[model samples]
Target chain A: MNRLMIELNGLKLEHPVMNASGILGSEPEHVDILVNAGFSGIVTKTFTKNPRNGYPPPIIVELDNGGYLNAVGLANPGINGICPVVERARRHGKPVIVSIGGSSLSEFIEVSIKAEECRATAIELNMSCPHVKGHGLDLGSDPSMVYTLVKEVVSTINTPVFVKLGLCDKIIESAGKALEAGASGVVLINTIRAMAIDVYTGKPVLSNKYGGLSGPPIKPIAIRAVYEVYREYNAPIIGVGGISSWRDVAEFILAGARAVQVGSVFMKNRRIVYEILEGLEKWIEIHGVSSIMDLVGLAHRV
Target chain B: MFKPALKTKTEQLSSTLYLAEFKLVEPVHSKPLPLQFTNIWIPGVDEIPMSIADYEEEKQVLRIIFKVVGEGTRSLRDRSGFFGVKGFLGNGFKTRGHDRILFVAGGSGIAPLPLLTRYCTIDNCIVDVVWGVKSSDMLFNIEKVALNPGSVYYATEDCSYGFCGMVPQVLQYIIEKEGVKWSTIIAVGPKPMLKSICSTIDPSIEVYVSLETMVKCGLGACGSCVLKPLPKLLCIHGPVFKCNEVNEFLESTHD
Candidate 1:
């Protein structure tokens, strides 16, 4: 009877829309806001082994037309920090995906087990954060490293594990390696490594000098990533990148994303989650569809 | 929403306070409001949010006055060239035609008051400012921004200025001496200062505060600048908040 409900491997989500990591799930109160905002799942800001102060100001640059350049340096409250955050989110009765980031295999396994211990619905390995070194795109770009990290983490935790990958040279190979290593799903296309230069100062805008680029400009790239990965492996996928409208969500599903995450767009419209849900509801009613998943890979057949 | 300022100017307001002016390439907040801030990025150094001291709407010029607090501000203090600027954003203060309005500020907390006082005077409201400073050198020509009945009052900790005491003590003395009901009170400064005044003051008085916190994104997407104990981000719900709106967080801070 709940048309928006979705079952992915071992995790069950209320709807197909979720908050992406690095957006607002840093504290318990932020979780409340996301829940009130009507997001079906709570995807937390990626957590590390220790507290990361991140970079100072100039961490983000909003581009002129549909893009965001950011280098937040994977700031989080640390692994133990997730206890209160997960406890608070569970009270709201929504699936909470704990995204874990690490510079090495031990850190990844360590954080993933902690997430499962905290009763996370799923664990997302942050393999493609473009800004941070050693942890993000550094490991994701190499398929063998993705295979090694995923295999080690999946063996350590019983919870459904997801591999979050960005745009890299061997993206399809990376996605395939993750699935082969026992990941439940793949989150396609983290922000691409990019930068912006201030014309006035004749210097790069962000303090880090280099950052990850996200938003509408990256949507087409994400769709291709999802479409290709689906065509090759037919694995469960969670799509994210430049998802500003409900139509964008539909597009991801047709391209074979079971669920989609929204990031930079939340900065522009806090009410977007509800708006997307309303629009999806109308689409389901109009299309006379009993299950939302029926739309997944529809574009592939056409 | 970060953009460059076309025309830039900086003036040393006091030994500690330096005022920077900019002609924005594009306005972040169309009509500027008091207590809102401009997130300034010092090229290769850091980014910081400074309270809007003044603005000329038609000219696209904005003014921010700040004191050096750390390495970031130190870099901001001496920077000569252009840097990224975002905002004139956040929920700013709204004025009601109250009979008597009192502003209690400490150090750089006085930054937002001048512009707000300007608006209060235009609405024909009686305004009084009780500002506290650590020493005399931090004090400057605030008389230009007048407060109707008693232009401005100072309480310097070093006894170099009027009323040698803390801001709250001077505030109490001013209210008792006036012997009239105050319509509103707005306080800003260090967290401890804002908390102490809020707790000691009469609960019946309407109070608003400008909170200080590290803000990264300014868009409220990052919870770096959250008003803890409450589900609000200062970048979104405030840099300015009514006492009633965030009473819980204030109460939590009291402990």
Candidate 2:
């Protein structure tokens, strides 16, 4: 029984499987469906202080090799709108992690408190969404800003706070600063900034002219990021990006992620959660691993 | 869910519309019912949702008809070799009974009609197809529309060949004159055209409309294709909805 349960910064989950932010976590109904689909935890879509309309049409372009380039621009139904979704997820006994993004520290602090007040088990500070301009990479790349933002939110909220870091050059430094500022965990590697241009038309394919790329293409990068972060601070890590199967979950756990969040693959089939959970259970049984906690950073063992 | 399908042919239906047929590398065990669509990825260009025009189960060939509306479609039209296709997506039209069927298609909306026509004829049901195009030159596959015993009605705005004016006017004339106790009306076209036809047709008759919107994922995950007011996800809930189910959607203003 211990082999399946994962404790993320003291919050215990039935399984390490969680829905990555921004897949189908926006509405209350989506959260209910995701919980019913068997994810141990559910991350609500990134919420801002107010409602955001997001980018115009043509926001997502599916790539070959089971990947996608999307510029959804973080279209979320404000902070207040997420209360019902969080409440619904909690009713199902799934740990509800609220993902919040904002351009200002006050906005982040306000939303984080709202999430905690709404009974969110955790809050994932989305300081790493790459496609959005002021709210994502710009805020994430600066270690000092991340430290201050996480510090303020952590101080105000009782819920465990996790800072989702991007693939920036200063990721290690940023992760360290976030942990020092009181973030209980870190979710590594948001979508990498990418774009696709139409060869015939000689123009960018995405309406935003740029988007974030996710799916199988970004798995290695996510793994490496997790490995590097765990090597240094050994903080509670939730690995995301390009995770599709149970093997990927094992890989992330081996690389130091205590839990894994799945996104793009859910776009292919919502039932993937059951498959991944089933595969993990079988793997633990065959390998005679005592528990999933023992497997964290197992690859780092000499 | 994603497979590399072989493009066997790209036939030009008109200056705007093109029909490209691809033979699935491995045949789908179950045929994607008529009105279901596929997401065709032209590698370097981009991927877009295209309505399945027809499918030959034995040959494992899938036909998709699309207009070169954007850069993606333009690139897709020119491509010749194999491309990745993710499909058998969206719920197809509900043609369950051997009831009298009327297919009202406007412009390139004729894409899915022939397949539905074929499905209905196999059950020996009476199918009346009313296809409206800009002109006679745009008409390419009237014969395919006439497949088996179904009657084909043409309405072109230019009066180049059939009834003059739009699809709804011709449909109104047919509904009043044919007096064929039609049970179902499946209309696919521009939103305004669908609205007009829905308004023109009697409320007692069941109508199914094939809707189009910007689709990123063929699944219901993305909220991109949600039909407003009711906010139904088109990819999963329907690309096909009874006219009454989405009658408000057709009339409402889209963002």
Best by lDDT: 1
lDDT of residue B5 for candidate 1: 70
B1-255 per-residue lDDT for model 2 (tens digits): 245587888888876788888888865677878799888766656668888888878888888888887888887888787676676889897566747888888988888866776777677777778989888888876564336536788889999978888988998898888884788888889998888877778876888888987677566666667676554778877899887788878888973
Q: What C-alpha lDDT values do all the predictions have?
A: 0.84, 0.83
Best by DockQ: 1
Q: Provide the TM-score for each candidate, comma-separated.
A: 0.94, 0.74
What lDDT tens digits, residue by residue, belong to model 1 across residues B42-131? Answer: 777777888888777778777778898898777776666666778666898877666677878899888876677666767767667888
Best by TM-score: 1
lDDT of 1 at A114: 91
For model 1 the TM-score comes to: 0.94
Error of 2 at A33 (Å): 3.2
Q: What TM-score describes the B chain of model 1?
A: 0.89
lDDT of 1 by residue, A13-87 (tens): 878999989888878988988888888889999999999988876888799887999999888999988877888
